[model samples]
Target: MGRETYTGDVAFEVRGHLGMITLNRPKALNALTQLMCESILIQLQDWAEDPTVAQVLIRGAGDRGLCSGGDISSVYRDMLEHQPRDGGGLLPESTPSYAAAMPAEEFFAVEYRMNLTIAEYPKPYIALMDGVVLGGGVGVSAHGSHRVVTERSRVGMPETTIGFSPDVGGTYLLPRSPGNTGLHLGLSGIHLTAADAIFTGLADTFVPSEALEELTQQLTEHPVDEVLPRYAKHPGDSAVEQDAEWIDAAYSAGTVEEILVELEQHSSSYPGAQQAAAALRAKSPTMLKVALEAIRRGAQLSLSGALAQEYTIAIHALRSHDFREGIRAQVIDKDRTPRWNPGQPETVDEDLVAHYFTPVPGKLLSLE
Candidate 1:
């Protein structure tokens, strides 16, 4: 097979029969930008049509992380300029209309399309996930045919922390998780190690972090169907069982507030549960409610239906106050103190949660 190059900030390299797509911005922990997403989609399309490319291997450049999330810092700056300051106030005279247009429905349309493409790609796709895999990273990795995790792999749907419901097929996958693990993780913004990921069905296989290079080499040399048997080893008992007691107790609650209250009440008995509770307590209350609702509703939906449902929620979330404020605190200002809408989970009404999933006129996600 001949090697070819695809140009972008993302490092696209083809060697042997496999094309490796590496998210290359190590300084930002490989946070994905719109350009990176487009570039990847283009490359995947090209490779999908090419006969020589036997498989696709997606990974990150450095050892620090896979990808932290989307480049929300840029999106947040744009949101501040376009939307009203408090109520319905107009943007300042100096604000650029281009910046204000960023949270455009088009972005979500393109991003969700990319995710759906990955999910339905003709060729085998393998994601070598090591280190942080959150938010948009989950979109890229989890959609693959084979998802490889390492001891260093830390996975989560941390969108609620930033006042966003889980997007990019999260509605589909999270609801598929056993028991209420998906609902629990989505609302709590918890991180799971490789072992935890495997137990929870988030990762297809586990490889030692030290063995990643060898695994990559094997993938480059062999077909993906054979790569696992050639180099992969059996994983140990998953870490999901470690938190079984706490997860069952807290996650079984009917509402987000009830879950939090349960966590707070049980924190003294389990240190891990205490940490998880603290993290959930710190996230956006509105996002938590929406995420919980999304998972609950998504559980009853087909894969495509869940994606369509998530499309509505995602578009509405962009126009909501909490999404921008959460991004400002977490990504832009780096203050780590989001002034969440409703301020408390208990204050968020069920109607507001339902509003997120309500369809917008002519805004349906076209899977075709």
Candidate 2:
């Protein structure tokens, strides 16, 4: 019908009865910020009530990716602003209690709410998950009714590598992945190709990257059901599906240490097994345990429950030493080496892991 446009880091347009959103920061891989999350949430709410908008389609502005993740560098800076300036103690007890609210709190609250909105959208919500879709990107895209992946799509929840567990409802989505593949991806922060994403139930249709523009044009002129079939193609067999046997066997172990032991003892035929073990060993030991527990607990909880639990974990993690250190190594310093608090998975106590699951005093995520 009528064409309209809204600008900023997140741009919005209405084109021929289609609601279009583009994450516009190509240089940073369209990394989401607090304002971006709020913009998306408000637009989704408005569109949900609008009669003219038949459907919604979201994609990135450039060829780099849909989104890298949340603007974690901002979150890191915010945490610094609110915490002790003398590089506060690394222990959980010595961390800031968040006596007053912080931007990080509002950021995640808005983001998780945005995720829930996408999940419950009334119209056909389509996400062109073309390239890098990790963390917050996955939250925005994976919950949509129509998740379109391409040959270039690379998906994962790489939270553990940052000394954090998966948030953005990742615990709910990844835990339901085929067999224990979710556990492997969560703990290792490994990227997934198109076929592997479909195999794990994270993506729906496969559309070639080159054909996306034409497909969007078709969508504007016709309904999705009529337009999708012409462009959607099978992604073919998934390597993750084939490796499920060893993946499941190793990740199914009771604890992270046991899982590592299982991986180390696996036959040479499964080269991936050893690689996974190495990946896990490199991540923050406490977070690895916390993430594994979160996934296991998430399997028994609903999406809302998992989101609530993840919120609690996020609050605690923000105050953690490893989270900051991990960010410094990976993002700021580019050192690629983080000296974890416990330094070893076996040293992470069950009590410390359990501590993360408790409710945050005044900051509970109210999904109801």
Candidate 3:
């Protein structure tokens, strides 16, 4: 009967039949933390069963973005403090004694589980995806039933730039995009405009940034299906869709190496083709190969299956040299130059790639 509000890094409020979630860490662009993930999951579960809650909406607190990604700085710190032994003889962090103590592993597990929840949420889950939505941001918004993007939206999964492959359901969602646009975006870690986001199937509608507040008011009073029609507008043309011929042609190649060759070959006709190749060339070679493989394999798997597979890869990546170096260059040191171990995509052998999929002992994701 009365308004209810809860607050922290994540906030929750109940207005009329609409339950709302606000990612509260605007300074960090609402970068998700383990506690935030757990909090969202708990609230989602509660709302899913509450008859009074007809639907739910998630938005970021500040104008910066919906969510930048997971709090990788925390993950970086945990890995640094608990560096695995060289020969892999270290005891398992998932062991019963240290289960709750393993922050990095637990963060991935909780975040991935929250992603799965969004994908399968019963009630309409509307996401106001304004500003910079990357990596973990994609997981939260893209999975929602009603994903709205604005002109200011800059969405992508940029894990490869940080020497890590995409996670938090990126493999499942990106591969399902039109043609090879997903592969191109995933490999290159490029941002998409609102039009491009809708074209790529990441967003359902486009609403002007200024209209979001009024739209929210409408949503509180009426159902999303009824309210969205009033605010959804044409986001104009998607540049990615215009360049789909080159993007699909280049990205459909058998491997990362061949994909580059295709991009280079198409450069004469398409201005962005050579740039795409250069972007791919700049990212961590190991992560590029791993990301490609995960996306390819993800296409054949269900969201849960893809998430499970990603969990293994994420655990393996925690011990990878590239992951740490990536965070250092991109986030900590701001060097913008990460010296990836393999250095070349061709040097990332299949055997080494296969090792990433090997399940970690005591760390399997039990997503039903």
For residue 274, model 3's alpha carbon misses the true position, in angstroms, by 1.1
What does candidate 3's lDDT look like per residue over 1-368, in tens digits? 43566799999999888999999999999999999999999999999999988999999999899999999999889877766423321234454423434579889999999999998999999999999999999999999999999999999999999988988898998899999999998999999999999999999999999999999888887999999988989999999999999998888899999999999999999989999999999999988989999999999999999999999988878877788888989998998998888889888878788878888677799997
**Model 2 lDDT tens row, 1-368:** 54656798999888887899999999999999999999999999898998888999999988889999999998889777766534422335433555667789889988999999999999999999999999999999999999999999999999998888998999999889988999998999999999999989889999999999999988887888889989989998888999999999998899999999999988476999989989998999999999999999999998888899999988888777778878878887889998888889878777888888877678799876
Whole-model lDDT per candidate: 0.79, 0.88, 0.90
TM-score: which candidate is best? 2
Model 3: lDDT of residue 279 = 95
Residue 82: error of model 3 in Å? Answer: 2.0
Better of 2 and 3 by lDDT: 3
Q: Backbone clashes per model, in order?
A: 0, 1, 0
- Can you rank all candidates by lDDT, best first? 3, 2, 1
Candidate closest to the true structure, highest lDDT: 3
Off by over 4 Å in 1: 87-104, 234-237
**Candidate 3 colliding pairs, count:** 0
Candidate 1 vs candidate 3: the lDDT winner is 3
In Å, residue 141's CA in model 1 sits off its true spot by 0.6
TM-score of 2: 0.96
Model 1's C-alpha root-mean-square deviation from the true structure amounts to 3.5
Q: Model 2 clash pairs?
A: 1-16
